[model samples]
Target: PLTVLQGYLEMMQEQVLEGATREKALHTMREQTQRMEGLVKQLLTLSRIEAAPALAMNDRIDVPMMLRVVEREAQTLSQEKQTLIFTVDEQLKVLGNEEQLRSAISNLVYNAVNHTSPGTEIRVSWQRTPQGALFSVEDNGPGIAP
Candidate 1:
């Protein structure tokens, strides 16, 4: 994603694209930048977990609110190439690390968007489950080869 963003920036710097094309490139750059930020956060979280595993868990997080934030971020990432459907139960809560939880959910959404073709509908849902809260990311895209 960073490579792609750099390419777009180079093109814009050279004024190789104009008008709506330039706008689109800028939009894509923004999305890629945001994605990179999430990736960095994920990396940091992993390092922290490795240093001290127990500290990574045990937070009382509002899953529904986190989903809402993820949904907004997904919109910027989607860029109209895909449709995002969010099914969130407002009452859902869980015990977890907020940063880790956000990263996991964002990763799922990002994977779906990056893997699927344009016009695909990606579904993100958080619901009450017998065991606890259930968070999912689903899409009608071609499945990965086994």
Candidate 2:
């Protein structure tokens, strides 16, 4: 994006493009700047979140219900490109920060859905484990080993 911005600026300086071309370049540069700003803000937020203390919201987390809502929200993320599904063996509850858990799982769903091809199916499921509980987001998207 920086390279493209530089090219546009050089073109504008050289008078190689004018009027509508100049407007388009300016708009593109604005968009690139906004995108960069957004990315920087996101990185800062992530840093802050990581540096914070461990989660202390000792509230009951209804796993199934939360996953269902996350699935609904995630559907809008991929829209026509992906399908989101949630499955649970039964109602399972845990204690944690509901907002934190939902955000973490929703991020996984988005990660799976966004990376997969059109018409891909993404599955979000949870089950009881010997240790406690397990949550997973499964997708046909090319993974690290791909």
Candidate number achieving the greatest lDDT relative to the actual structure = 1
- Indicate which candidate wins on TM-score: 2
lDDT of 1 by residue, 19-119 (tens): 89988998998998988997798788778867875654678898887787878888988898999999999987888778767766777788788778998
**Candidate 1: pairs in clash:** none
User: What would the TM-scores of all predictions be?
Assistant: 0.64, 0.71
TM-score of 1: 0.64
lDDT of 1 at 29: 88
For 1-146, candidate 2 gives per-residue lDDT tens digits of 67777888888788776788778888999988876775686587678779989878789888788877777778777776887777786678889888778767776777687679998788778988899898988888876353
Provide the lDDT at 14 for model 1. Answer: 81
Candidate 2 displacement at residue 87 in angstroms: 1.1
**lDDT, each prediction:** 0.82, 0.79
Where does model 2 exceed 4 Å of error? Answer: 1-38, 142-146
Name the lDDT of candidate 1: 0.82
